[model samples]
Target chain A: MNREYKTGEIQAGKPVQQVPWLEWLAAGIGLFLVLGIFGVIGWQALNGATVPPVITVTVENVTPVEGGYRVLFRAQNTAGEAAAQVEVEGKVSTDSGEEVSQVVIDYVPGHSDRRGGLFFTRDPSSGTLAVRAIGFADP
Target chain B: MTSERYAIGLARAFGGAIIFGLPLLMTMEMWSLGFSMGRGRLLLLVGFTLAVLVGLSYFSGFEKTFSLKEDAMDAFAAFGVGVITSTLLLVALAVITFDMSWGDIIGRIALQSVPASVGAMLGRKQLGAEQDMQAEEERKQEAGYAGELFLMLAGALFLAFNMAPTEEMILIAFQMTPWHALALGVLSMLLLHVFVYSIGFSGQESRPEGGTFLSTFLRFTLAGYGIALLVSLYVLWSFGRTDGVAVAEIANMLVVLGFPASLGAATARLVV
Candidate 1:
């Protein structure tokens, strides 16, 4: 009968090397762990507890029209991206002799540039046009 | 038991150093000095040759045991591997950050790393040390490696906060000077070495617990200064004014400075 060579030694074929499958599996798991960690970190970093929307409303053009002022606005996004689900709102006002006239308009799911036109068709002799923006300020 | 194993180990250590160190040094020096790759390559070539000449001076007493030419070649291979590994990592980072398209990033990193790796390998091999001091040298090498890694982290951070143009973080991260980076890396390592010694030499057993704390406190305080020096320079240079510094940005900067110091501490703990 064949016998073993020595202590701390075994036949070339019989020697049980570290389980290849286990090693591979372990390595695979290790890799996944590393990737998962990085992915989670990156995700959390890019969009964490508070991530502001992409596009932001910034006043671009305000001009006086026949009846009311034609207001033009732009959405500035410096985060290297485009954003959706924008809402644009405008408020126009004029002060007459003793009375103040005001008009409010809202734009939902506004187009690109977060831009939508608003005509405050107020009586030219009544008051002035005042425009203010609402929705999405990246602070 | 045999000297051959030790020689191989030395070769690996030095080889690893060259494989890694060349690209690092070159990147930093060139960047700091405002030299591009083409000019930097020329400088690297000249500087590497000079370093080899200087490094070889140590073996003037015994030439038989060590071969400079052979070491240089081996160092080149190791350096190539190091550059490849680093470049790949850089490329992957760029891709993930959406800084570079897969095609552009891969092409650029691969192209730059290949030649840089070759230069690094050669530079490392050329830098030689005596065989008699192998054990001590190996310890030093390990310490140095830890130091370099920490320094790199610091340097990377410094670059990220200061030199990296916010509009082009990805590009600048890759394109920053290798030679300057390496110098800072070496400096960081040196600081770590001193820290290691300070901690190791300071006796704690005979003294009161507060005494040990005091010594550690002193050691760490000095270490803090060293980190602060780099961070301060970065802040002054980048922000133009240290006043009104953003807390988060400061944290990021400190993270960079702390990287190498921690590395040195960890290595010292492990080795000593």
Candidate 2:
């Protein structure tokens, strides 16, 4: 804390009067970030939608596991609101019977996608597979 | 020599940012809340945090400041350090990826920067040399009653911000009955008073000359607890914990969060 002050920079018991250029540079960067963040949020407030989450689930692939078949799917929320506890159901219509597999995604944010896997005892590739988001809870 | 001191201060600011910001930075709830939270509320929060940082700089900035302009500059500099630190950490952790929207990235960084900036502002007091701390102590004594309350508010906000983003706040509230809430509230206030007045921490304040126990309790302890509760509510609301929540549940949550907030308020002198 032993600051070296110039002749005119200090008065009796007062802090040094002159600020360094580096301080100003740091402050400028901060100001930019603050303003930029504010602007982005403000823009979103003006234009962001308030629609409920609309989730679309699509199966990515089906693979064989040791005991069963694994169906990987991606859940995409196209709406402006996020959803929690989203239920994605995959149904397979085979010559033998109809098999259903369900998986719950914890969260699917607006305009974002989440991947999950559903397990089925029967091979999903052997039947016509139908995958869709059944329901979602508001986040 | 001045430049060298400033450089050291800057490095300390970075260290402080990491130490204070790490908890919130690693929180999964905080990362999600950034994008899920209401944009208007998020904006208000960022604006409010900047104001708090400026006030903190006035009391104990990274450098000795003689004027409001100096304090404001330091506040902004602290914010810059916070934003940079948050951005770098988020990237390293894979929380901020190339595929994410710019909005999500900005939101995450903005929310995290609140605590990081406060840490940077307090870097001087926590990490500075001994003589620097003495100077800050002198500056703190110059503050009056209003200033003391403001410090309490800042302290409460800091602690509440740390816990409010977690799901446990609401979960604990839901688990508590009305009787439990009442007991916890009383216990929180009692602990807060003991920490500030009864116990003699290193930076503890002595009772003012001729100040009676009742007067001190009413003026500092009670008022500090009130501020703590208010700050807790604000933090909870900012994190969207109050959305669609029942009134009784909200009250319970307030009590739960108020416990830590009160401790933070009581320890303001030692910490802030």
Model 1, span B105-127: residue lDDT tens: 22233323333443333332334
Worst 10 residues of 1 chain A by lDDT: A103-112
A1-139 in candidate 2: lDDT tens per residue? 2223322355454444357778888889999999999998787677653578899988898999999998899999887777888999999889999999888888887778888998889887888999999998876
lDDT values of the candidates?
A: 0.36, 0.85
Candidate 2 off by > 4 Å: A1-17, A62-70, A121-126
Task: For model 1, state the Cα shift of residue A21 in Å.
Answer: 37
Residue B83 accuracy (lDDT) in model 2: 95
Residue B93, model 1: Cα distance from true site in angstroms: 11
